[model samples]
Target chain A: MQQRDNENRLSQEYTNSVLLNGTLQTPKWWPYLVSILGFFVVIGFVLFGIQIKYGLGVTGLNRPIYWGLYITTFVFWVGISHAGIMISAILRLTQAEWRRPVTRAAEILTIFSLATALVFPLIHAGRTWRIVYWLIPYDASRGIWPNIRSPLFMDPIAISTYLTGSTLFLFVALLPDLAVLRDRTTGFRKGFYTILALGWRGNPRQWKMQVVGGILLSALMLPIFVSVHSIVSWDFAVTTAVEGWHSTIFAPYFVIGAVHSGVSAVVTMMALMRWGWGWNEFIRPEHFDALARLLTVVATAWLGFTFLELLFALYGLDAPEIALREMQIFQYPWNMLFLTFLLTGYILPVPMWIFKRIRTNIALMFWSSILVNIGMWLERFLIIVPGLARRTPFVFTWEAYSPSWFEWYILFWSFCWVTLLMLIFSRVFPLVPLFEQKESEVFSDDIKIGRATVPTIFREEEE
Target chain B: MVAEKNRSWGMVIDTDKCNGCSGCVTACQVENNIPLNDQNKFERGRVMSWIRIERYWEGEFPNVKARFIPIMCQHCENAPCEPVCPVYATYHNNEGLNVQVYNRCVGTRYCANGCPYIVRMFNYWEPTWPEEIRNHLNPDVTIRSRGIMEKCSMCMQRIKRGERNAGDQLQDGEIKTACQEACTTGAITFGDLNDPESEVSILAKSDRKYSLMPQLNTNPNVVYLATVDPYKDKNLGEKAKTNEH
Candidate 1:
């Protein structure tokens, strides 16, 4: 028993050293990678500055096609943020043990992606400086309350609420880890972790409170998780003026699409985490296998929603709706994008994901997950731009949108910005939660039946 | 100041009389201080004309006849653009005008997306005028800065001025919108629809009158008198099939 305890302690020490490497001891490539991402992020901010100084004209926006790439990327990032709630909150409620290693990275992705998503509307606006009037209720003294009736108003409210909740959820899960960092570090790092740790002592009472807080937050956040994407979908769905936009299916369609893309993004992040940190033991093929199985189910459901949306769109047999769908599907460029969206969004990756070999292959999962995002981004683009570009009663205004290079650069910048934030976050916190890792180690056991031994995870029964 | 009066302002366009001259388009641009729609603007699909004359071909190219309909902000009673504006920059005013408060507009362009007529135009760039033509700009209208939405106020400046001139008992013919004033064929008529004696009110009651995209139920104040097509009956079957879709 004493020998077993020593072996367990040595294993825990190895786990701590490996997970805490970034915070405790810096990696050689960390600074270089951060600088490169930071350089691009700064350049993106400058380009945005130039865009603001000139006008929205710098982008490809026109009279009819008022929204383009910015809005598309906006919805894309919002969709990407569904990773956190899906992995941490939903899986926790369902008592999924494999969620232990990935919860932090997924939650961090949510926070950063959401922060990035919130910026698109302001920058996409004609008057970015004056967006405060739309955002704030400060003008109520003039008897003009910000139009609560506006979906635009609801968007900010819903998004900010989710951001706040996610941040709290992240921080709650982070407390024990922060306390660990505090004990291990010195000087400024120690001070930083000390304040953030909130006097977490690993006492029984504190652990109980932490667990209760996490569970409570997860339960509370489930509604917000559903509402955030639903509201985002409503922004497009409620607009009756756009041919393909006014749909009842948008809410469920967007939510499911978000999960498909978001989970894929998490898979992509997990593959990168495994490779980049060399955490082979922690984030294993089994984890990827579990995520792939979940994704196969998610991607299929999303495909169903996609077809259902199309079916309902065509159900009315409305001439304009048919014309829009035709241009979206049969026309030269849009048809190509539609094909690519279908291939990458579901057909290619989902089929590959069905096979256990591909599901367990890290390299294949990474590339496939990246493809899913590209397809998801195209899906949003296809929805937004085509609806605007559709033939109205006035043929004179029929025109196609081509995103400007500046818009493309800005889109590129958002990716870099999110990545930079993630890298910075990793430098401070373990991407994989340490406490959860230890818990998993403690909970893991092997049982023998006759000559066969099988691995199992067990938790203590609640009193 | 004009005494506040309950007036439902409206417009009636006689498509039969319109020669597709584009006089109203140019007149509205000048009157509203709309940015010069240069070739670059046209190519980019960002032209800022407050009103446009859409010409539709009625038949095969050999026997084709052009039908012109001047379209503008319908100033709908149930304006889709109004409620969607987060800043309340666009709203229905007491004078029955669909008012677009320029300064209040932060230009989310949500209102533009909501407008089925697609009348709302965003100032994609700051409005500029050559030094020689700078004085020609109408000082009565505010020069909309880049990044805000502007649309046909139905020449609200003129309506306010007309009301201020006429005081308590404003006459129907007193307010002539820029489009009406410039229309050489008497195609465009503007007046208070509340007055039964108004020319617009009488024209709006005509059997040929219709509103654009009536299925959307915008309930527009701008009424159009359908073109008196001589060949309409000859192609009735084709037209019916087209309408059925």
Candidate 2:
């Protein structure tokens, strides 16, 4: 019994050292990676500066095609932001065991991607500087409150609420981990973790409170998660003038699509984390297998929504609506894009994911997840642009949209910015939740029934 | 002079009388201080015309008949662009005019997207004019800057001036919009819909009267009279000859 306890303690110490690699001991390549990502982020800000100074004319936006890549990328990032809540909150409530290792990384992706998503609306506006007026009520002075009916107004409110809630959820989950770092490190880092730990001593009461806080936040954030993407969809959906955009299916379509992309993004992050940190022991093939199964279901549901959107659009049988559909599906460049969107978004990644072998392969999983995002982004692009480009009865006003190189750079910049923030975050905190990993170890056990051994998870009873 | 109570500003456009001269389009640009739309702007699909003459060919080859209709802001009573604007920059006024407040506009282009007529125009760059023609800009109108939406205000400055000039009452013909005044064939008439005796009110009751895209139920103040095409009905031309005989 003494020898067995010693072996368990040694393994526990080994797990702690591996999980806390970034916080306790910085990696050799950390500085180099940060600097490289930092360079790209700086260039992105500079490009934004140029866009502001030169006016929105720098983009390929025109009279009829007022929104282009900016709006598409905005929706994509917001969709990507859905991963955290879907994994950490929804899965937690459902009591999914595999969610433990990925919960933190997914939540971090949610907060950072959401923050990036909020930036696009402001920058895409004609007057970026004047966007500050959107936050406050001007009722006392001008008797003009921001139009509560406007979906654009609702977007910021929903997004900011989600961001705040996600940040709090992240901080709450980080407390015990912070205490771990606080005890392990010295100097500025120790002080940093100490302030954040809030004197979490890991007593029975603190643990109970922490667990309860997480559960309550998970419940609160669920509605916000749904509302954020729904509001984003309404930004386009409420416009009756845009033929393809004004659809009742948009809210659910957007939410499901967001989940599909968001969860895939988490999978991509997990693959990278495993490869980069050499955490093969923690983020095993089983985790990828579980996420892949979740993704297959999500991607399939997303496909059903896509089909429904297209079906109902044709069901109207309106001349303009038909013409718009014809142009979106049959037209030259749009047809190509439509095909690409299908191939990348659903047709390609989903079938590969159905096979157990492909799900367990990290390299294949990474590339397929990346392909899913490419498809999702193209899906948003196809939805936004082709609708705008649809030729109206006023034939003179019909125009095509081609995103400028500047716009492409901005899109690229957004990725760099998100990655940089995530990297910086990883330096301070463990990407995988340490306590959850330890708890999972305790809960997982093998039972031998006759000659067969079955793996099972056992949960502690709540008092 | 008696002040008309609950006056509703409106227009009656006779499409048959419009010859596709595009005079109103030019006049509007001058009167509203619209930025010069050069060849480059046209190429970029950023032309800033407040009023445009849309020409549609009726038939093929020898039977072809060009139909001309001058299109501008319909000024719908239930404007789709109004509610979508986060800043409340555009709204319907008591005078039955769709008003766009320039200073309040943050230019999300959501209003432009909401407008079915494609009348709203966004200023992609600062309004500029060559030094030679700089003095020709209208002093009464505000020159809209870059990164904001601008559209046909129905020449609100002219309406205000016409109201101010009239001591107690405004006449039917007094508040002539820039497009109405410049129309050589008197195709466009501006008047108060509230006054039962007004020409526009009478025209609005005509058999040929219709609003653009009525299916959308916008209930626009600007009514158009469909062109009386004799070629549309072969019997109509024969009936005219027989009646003359």
Which candidate number has the best DockQ?
1
lDDT of prediction 2:
0.89
DockQ of each: 0.83, 0.77
User: Model 1, range B37-74, lDDT digits (tens) per residue?
Assistant: 78899999899988999888777766777778888999
Runs with alpha carbons beyond 4 Å of true place in candidate 2:
A1-10, A138-141, B1-4, B235-245
- Expressed as tens digits, the lDDT of each residue in A39-131 for candidate 1 is 999999999998788888899899799989999999999999999999999999999989999999999999999999999999899898988
State the displacement of the C-alpha of residue B56, model 1, in Å, after optimal TM-score superposition.
0.9
Q: Which candidate gets the maximum lDDT versus the true structure?
A: 1
State the lDDT at A227 in candidate 1.
96
- Among the numbered candidates, top TM-score falls to 1
Lowest summed-lDDT stretch of 10 residues in model 2 chain A? A1-10
lDDT of 1 at A206: 96
Tell me what TM-score chain A of model 2 achieves. 0.97
